[model samples]
Each structure stands twice: as structure tokens, then as C-alpha cells.
Target: MAQVGHESHGLTKLEEGFRYTKGISQIPVKSAMREGAQALESARLEALRGRPEALADLMYGGRMGNDEPGDGYKYRGRGYMQLTGKDNYRSAGEALGLDLVHHPDLAAKPENAARIATWYWQHNVSQNAREDVTKATRAVNGGTNGLADRESRNERWLQTLTPELMEQLAAGRIGRAVEPPAPATPARTAPNAAADGVLKAGEKGPAIETLQKSLHALGYTDGKDRALNPDGHFGASTKEAVQAFQRAHGLKDDGVAGPKTLDALKKAEQTPLLSNPAHPDHAMFKQAVGGLEKLGPQAGFKNHAELERAAATLTFEAKVGGLERIDHVALSTNGTGLFAVQGNLNDPGHHRAHVNKQQAGEQPLEQSTFQLQQDTQQRQKLEAQANPNQTQPPPTRAMG
Candidate 1:
């Protein structure tokens, strides 16, 4: 609350303003310009005095992912924490499942401002702040721009939020507590008020049934991995499933199926399933394959065929032999083999490539004799490169 109050000036200034006088502009411009973060000539700075848009563009363009023209002004500081720049907005939007890139002003909306502020603090400052106001201020402002003011606010807030005050507020003895208003009632109940079609708990109908079905199809289950029943009842299990789905897809886990969450769920449902006729558990295998394909060239696979091969190997190992589940797969830098890292997001294993070597004259995955030989040679080369001194035994195969 202190940090937010300091950043947004008591929640009155959600969006940043740039109507600075020539001399006033120089203060922030010069401070932010240190180390060539922003390059503006003295004449140019003086000329940009009262032009908010022009000043914002000059100061913020070409940095912080503001590649497009007018992006600086469009993505200027907003929200309680004054989230600035294209990248920051986009990131917060992804985390919250809000299209902040196109709808940048959403960050300044009273409903979203606090959420964005909290998200920013959690991701960027919480780890380092640790009861230190200066570190928190620097993390939020990129410098100690309001260190003294923030410290003062923190002290004042600490004094105001005593246990007695909290108890009174909780007991309704005091006036309304200082919190953002409850989200406009879900669209199902308040059609006229809701701009976004939102489905919150206690709203049960076809819309919620559809949402539950989508969540079930996408493999989001309750705490015990029990699939959600498409009973059209927005019960606790359904809400938990929705929240789990949101968490996995980098969306805000508010358990309300809003427009953004609905869209992401639809996209996840529509992802193409991989087809490998030879694999047993073809349905599960295809889903795993689809995930790998979605990872795409970014994970270093050169083409679909390579991804298919790696997926086939991992799926086969998981289903037929030694692995629990196909969790992580990565292609080697030189594209020689796949590195399968076992474990889920919570408990990741070591970062080591475990290659399964085929016995001499043995054929796997219907690979031709020549292809098998080539694979053998590549594996040998990789092993040699990995250990030039032969100090340790050759790399062993571990199923992910």
C-alpha cells in the first residue's frame, strides 16, 4: 500500500503526465539519461517542454521493447506502480491474461491498476526488497526517484495499519477498507455492467459447463487429478480447475473465466494434436507431441521431423519402458541428439543429456541401418566432445 500510494500519488495519478516546463523536464530527463539510457540533445530537450506525447516518445522510444512509433506515449507509466514501456505492459498483460499491449489503458483502470502493481512487485521486487525501502524503491522506479517520499509513506502506512485498525475494519466498525472495489459483478448476473463476459463462482449455466469442459479437455484437473464433470455447476472443483489452468498458461488465477481466460482456453483446446500411428496411448502421446510442437523453433528443433523424432522417443520411453512421464525435451545445440530432462515444473532434474544408445545392428523407430550407424557416430562424437579426457565414463541414458 505504501509503495502504491507513493507511486500513484494516493491513487489519483494512475497515468503518468509529461507536461513539464523546460527546466523541470531537465531534472528527470537528465536523471533518466544517465549512462546513455536516453539520448537527447540539450536543444531537443528544451524544445520538448510542454508536449507530453513528444516528450514521452523522445524519452521512452527505442528502449524497453517500444519498437513501434508512438509506443512510448501509448505505453507510458500507468497503474499504481506506474508500469511503463511496451515490454512491461506486455509482460503484465500475459501474466494477468489481459491484452495490455493493444489495450494499454487497461493498466490505468481502477480495477486492474492494483493487480498490475501487485504482479510487478511479486515478479520484480519482492525477492530483493526484503524489508528494505530503498531496494524496493530502486526496483520499482529504476532509481531512487522517490526514495524519501516512499520511505515516509511506508512509515505512515505502517503506523496506520495497526492490528486494532485492521480488526475494526474487518469487523465493519470502520468505514470501507482501502481496497479496490469488488470486480463489477460477473457478466452472467450483470449483463449491462460487464464489459467483458466474466463467469465467476456461483454462476452456473451452459457458459460454465462449456468452461468446465474446456478445462477438462486441456488436462486441468482438481487437486487429486480428478477430471472436472461438465455438470454446469460452478463448484469449488471447477473453480480450482480454472485457477490451475490459468496458472499453467501464465494467466491470473482469479478463478473467474473472463474474456482473456476464455480466449486462452479456446486456443489451448484448438492446438493441433500430433499424429503418430505407431505409438500406443496415441491420445496422450499426441498431446505431448502437440506441446513439443508448440514449443517450436525456440526450443532449438530445426524442423517438425526432428521434433517428431524426439517426441516419439520420449513418448515410447515413457509408455513402454522406463520413464514416468515425458516432462522436458530439448535439442542439443549441434542437433545431434535430444536432451530429456525428467520432472515437472516444481521439481526439475539436473541439466544433463541422457542418450539411449542402440545396440549394434539393432533397429529402433524403423530407422534404416545407415541412419542408425550415423546416429551412433554422432553420439560418439558428442560423448568425446563432452569428455575429452575420458575422466568419467560415457554419458548414460536416463528416461525423462
Candidate 2:
């Protein structure tokens, strides 16, 4: 039942309480009586479920229940967190065993709030904390903060969720932190780098390989799988690292996690603690993905998550002469520049588009950065799709 309710609860904030970028599962204070206390409790890493303070807060914070159906600070931080005013108090309470009108502070107790949160996590939010939180927040707050309005609380609890929360309390940080699983055997690939694109023999994509290599170099590697492969495809191990990185940096657990994801992963390699993972790449990745999202509105998204939806689901199709064309999907992580090919625009297999591909003499890493900058190409392609009748302008600027 708790799991069912959690799935229905919606998204959360990634960076404090700003916007709902995704709709992952969230553990919130369901009873209005717990809202006030839940709000504070949720923001305190020290009182999470496994911690000793959790039960203690339930006793003290749970006592002050209110009367109004939705009155216990519904607007300020109501709903699940007892955020503010009347509506949230009533709604959250109605969902839980308590009635907000009778016991508004149901949301105030850390234990009750944690109980609801745990229920949510066990059922819905836990499926994919990163993505669900991001999606739900988008549904709630819109794009103002790109996170649901509960990131502060989420981040706080997330800090305590280190490997130690799994019922295994170690004496030091190394024991408590969520380290990558040890190798089932020996690591075959040596470490490489993202900036250099120097992956080991088994790797594939430039970006994937780069990330893997960088992760390994930065100590985010398994004792095994040291074999470097550079396919650039984000795989399982990468996903785990990303989750750890998000928690450390306060990002939602969306596995498609990118630059901010990378920065946090890198930092864990460096500092290894609960530090603010919000970085410049986070903003840049947001910008780049934002551009992808725009393509949907101008070009149209089929049924996928729309850019307007905040998940940046961009539905696009490359058609030629009324026949649908299968344009290859390439992320900046796919390689460093545009996939360039010198073919006639009028060629039957292809069309005239700016080509930004292979060049010699430049380091591969520089090329990757150059490629990522080409996200503009996607925006332009979207524009072309939206208004195909617009006359193609001739190149007028001088070459750099």
C-alpha cells in the first residue's frame, strides 16, 4: 500500500527545492500532522531511517497535530512535507492513515514521514530514484529550478544513505561510503580518460570509453573490469557510478545523467564526500538537453516525454521525399565533432547539411569538446524540419 501511494506521489527537487525535472519516487510526510516536522526532518541527514534520531523525532515532532483539513502549513511546504498550508495537510493526511483535519502533524513526525517516504521508495521512487525524482519535480514545479520543490530534503537524507545505511556500519568513511562493487575477479583494462579519449582495448564509444577511463583513473572502478573499452555507450557500471555521483552532488538519480554526473563522479575520485555536485557542466548539460527538447515543440514529439515535459523527450524523424529517413542518433559523447561526410546534398542517400567530422592534427579530446558544441546542429535540424520551406542561406562568414 505504501509503495502504491509513493508511485502516485510524484517527483522531487534535485538542487534544494527548485523545479520538478523528473518524476521519480519520493518519500514524503503524508499526514498533515507530520508535515511541519517532516519538512525539517527530511532536510536533516542525521535523522534518516537507519539513524538513531529517526525514532526520537517521531516522538517529539509527531505530537503537534493540527485541526484544519489542510491547514498545517500547506503552502509553505505542504503536501507531503507539510510544506505550508491547509490543502497539503488534508491531502497528505487523507492518503495516509491519519486525517489531516484531525491530526495535522501526521507529516511532522520524522518516523511517520520517513515511513511514508520509505513506502514510496520501496514501491515507486526506488525503481529509479534519479529519474523518478527528476520527472516528478518537473510535473510539480515546472522548469524554474529543473527539480521538484523538495531537493533540500532529498539531498539531506541522501547524504546519510551512504553504503552504511544498508545495515552495515563501518568505522570510517571508506567503510560507510558506497563504493563500486569489488571485482568478481581481476580488472582487465587499465584506466584511461574522458578528456583524452584514451580507452583500453575492449572499450567502444569515445564518450563511454572516455567516461570509463576517467572513472577508473579517478578510482571509480571495480577491482575487476579494468579492461578499457571505449564504445561511448553508458552501461550498467556507469549507471551505478552516476547514482553515487548524484547523491554526493545532490542530483536526481536519472541514469541518463551527464556532465554534472561526470563532475560528481570525478570529484568522488578526488575528495570522496557529500559535496555539492552542482557544477558548470550541470548547467551546460541542461542547456544542451534543453536544446534537444525544443526540437519536439518545433518538430513535434510522438508520445515520448516532451521537452515541455522536462524529461527532454525529443521525438524527431528525418524524412526524404516523403519517405522517413533513419538519421543516426549521435550524442556529443558519441565523438568530438559533427559526423562529417563529403557527399552531395542532393545525393539520393543524404542531403546537404553542415558536416563537422574527422580532422587530423587535433587531439581527440579537443575534438570531442568541439563535437559537443555541435548540439546547435540538432537545433538547426529541428528548425529545418519545422520550416522546411525556409530558403537555405549561403555561408557568408569567413572561415576561422
Candidate 3:
């Protein structure tokens, strides 16, 4: 525990988060020297086996990679918690109105250290803090390596930081705490009202279309076999699409557009789906798309639904690996003909994607595209037969 102390009870949730994670306000200048020395010694011991180079790999993600000797010691763990790494030094400096890039030691200063740690917690961990402490810990440590220590620190600090608890402590009133409310289940609210309320399978309306469009925008192509027939209808295609989105985003794949799902959809509209910054390369991604495009439309009646579906699947696949943004899509020269379905969506990840025509089942992308195309056609035909009134016009030459 570095510079452990009590926090003011009047702090807001965000403020409390900062105090709790960063070990309260700021350590005194003289005292900070002791804390900083201790932190450096710990980091030194951890770096002893493979030297600072190994520690640099762990802290800065090999960004420096020993290219700059002594970078490991120069950019070692510092600050209220551990602002280790060149990128973090620069980022924290920018956030705190300091020039930390040149003076890395500045981040270790008592006040600067506190501000840097608080800034990191607020920006990265605050959003999910209400529901999960595990997310916050992962945000800081990258995993649950010292989860027990973190939880213990959080429990001790939080008790002193809250107004209710502080008042109880002042009055010498010690007692067991009240239990919190149970978490809400992840299911659609209404069973019958599909169009207006929870959009489930078999509901046809503008709301269903809205949901479909939202999914499509986030790379969930429920209509990948053909044009997205946001024909105001929620069928197995829509259900499967929603479930895919849920699974990718760590939600309950209930296949229902419930409030939580709807909220996530709205959030997606505002922010990119991939939270991680690391992504694949553009050229490799293009090659993978080329493979899918070569398959063309399968035994479909008309139009290139298979092509569109493949593009959507590839796009979603890239997203799962932390693609930042989609630049533009490159489609083949062929028109609406079966062979016209060649194209690639580029991202930084350089991730390769293969079209799995088996969109109706739990098949992986490793299967052949021909088999996937056959499975999709069968599922589409079954859906069409079940609802004869669901036909729609061919989609315009636009790729989402």
C-alpha cells in the first residue's frame, strides 16, 4: 500500500474513485520521496531477472523494445500508483498540463502523481465501476494478478470515504452493513409487444427495422445472405444477429432487443465498438476479404446476398479483435450478379476473415465458404416460407 490514508467524506463518486484508486489526495513532498523510492525498489526487483528490458516489455508493451537503453529505468513505474511507460508519461503529462515526456520524474512528484493516477481511473474505469470492481482492477493492472490486494485496498478505503460510513464511525456506531439490491436479469421486458417494446423474433414494424439498421451499423449483418431487408420484421435472422452482437459485447446472448441491449446499441452509435486500440493490418484483411469475395453468391434465387453477408461477417470479425474504425469498402467490378460480390473492408488490425455460409448455426469461420453458403440459403428459404409476406426490393449498391 503506497501512501495509504483517509479521504474526505464529501467527495463525489468520481472524486471518491480517484481517492480510492490513487490512495487519497496527495502525499507530502518529503513523504513522497520515501514512497517513490519504495515503488522504484519494488520495480527494480521485478525487473531484476531480465533487467529493465523485460519490465519495459511488461509496462510499455514493447513500444521502446530496448531501442532506447535505460528506458526501462527511465520510464519505470512511478506516480501515485504506477504510471509506467513512455506513452503513459506523455499522456498523463498532457492531461495534467505538465511536460512529463521530457521530465519523467515529474510524474513521480506527489501532486502530479496523484493527478495522473486519478485521471487514468476516471477515464478508463469509471464507466463500469458502478456494476463491476473487476473491470476497474483490470483497467489498471491489465488482469487480476493482484486482485486480492486491490479488493482489500478498495474495501478499506471505500469504508472511510463514504459519508454514511464516516458519520457512523464518528458516532461510534459499528454494525453490519445493509445488503445491496439484486442485479437485474438480461431479458426482454415485454413478451407480446415486439414492435414498440422489446423487439423479439417475428415482430414486423419500423422499430424492428431500426434495430436491424443499428445492428448493421455496428457490423451485425442479420441480412448478410442478401440485402438487409430491414423490412420491419424480426425473424430468426434478426434474433441471430442480435445474439451475435450480445456475445461480442459480453452480454447475455438472449436474442432479444431488451433495454440493456438497446442501451448498448445507443452507446455503439456514439462510440466505436472496439474498446482495445490494437488492430490488424489493412493488406492482410484485404486478402482475407478477397478469399470470401471469390466465392460469389451461392444457390440463391437472385441478387448477391451472400456477398453482402460475407462482408458483414468479416467486418464483425475485425471488430472483435479491436478495430478502431472502418475507412472504406472495396467492392468488385461485377454488379448485382453472383460473381459481383467481391469486396474488402479495411482496418488497422490486418485480420484475415473467411465467409462462413453457415450463418444459421454455431459454426466457426474455419469451415469452407461453399458449405456456409449452402447453410445460409437453406435458412433463408425456410424463413421466406414461414413468412410469405416478408419479400422486399433488392438493395441499392450501397455497402454499410
Which number leads on lDDT?
1
- Per-residue CA lDDT of model 2 for 1-400, tens digit only, reads 2121222233321111311111111223333225464554443323322342332243233333433332222223322322333444455556666665555455555556655454434333334444455654433333223232144335434555655454454444444456666657774663333445332222334566567666544323221112223335454445544443344345876654456665654544553211113422233224324444444433222222222212111111111112122233222343323221123334566532222222210112212222232443666789889987685676688889
Off by over 4 Å in 3: 1-61, 64-67, 165-400
Report the lDDT tens digits of candidate 3 across residue range 152-258: 44554564467766777787766857555468678565344453558776555668888888766555544222124465657656776788677655689989889
Model 1 lDDT tens row, 3-46: 89867866888888653322333345443354343344432433
Q: Could you give the C-alpha RMSD of every candidate to the true structure, in order shown?
A: 22.3, 20.0, 20.2
Q: Put the candidates in TM-score order, highest first.
A: 1, 3, 2
Query: Global lDDT for candidate 1?
Result: 0.63
Query: Which rank order by lDDT, best down to worst?
Result: 1, 3, 2
Better of 1 and 3 by TM-score: 1
Model 2 TM-score?
0.22
In model 1, the runs with Cα more than 4 Å from the true position are: 22-26, 29-50, 128-130, 166-400
My TM-score estimates for the predictions, one after another, are: 0.39, 0.22, 0.29
Candidate 1's TM-score:
0.39
Tell me the whole-model lDDT of each prediction, alpha carbons only. 0.63, 0.36, 0.49
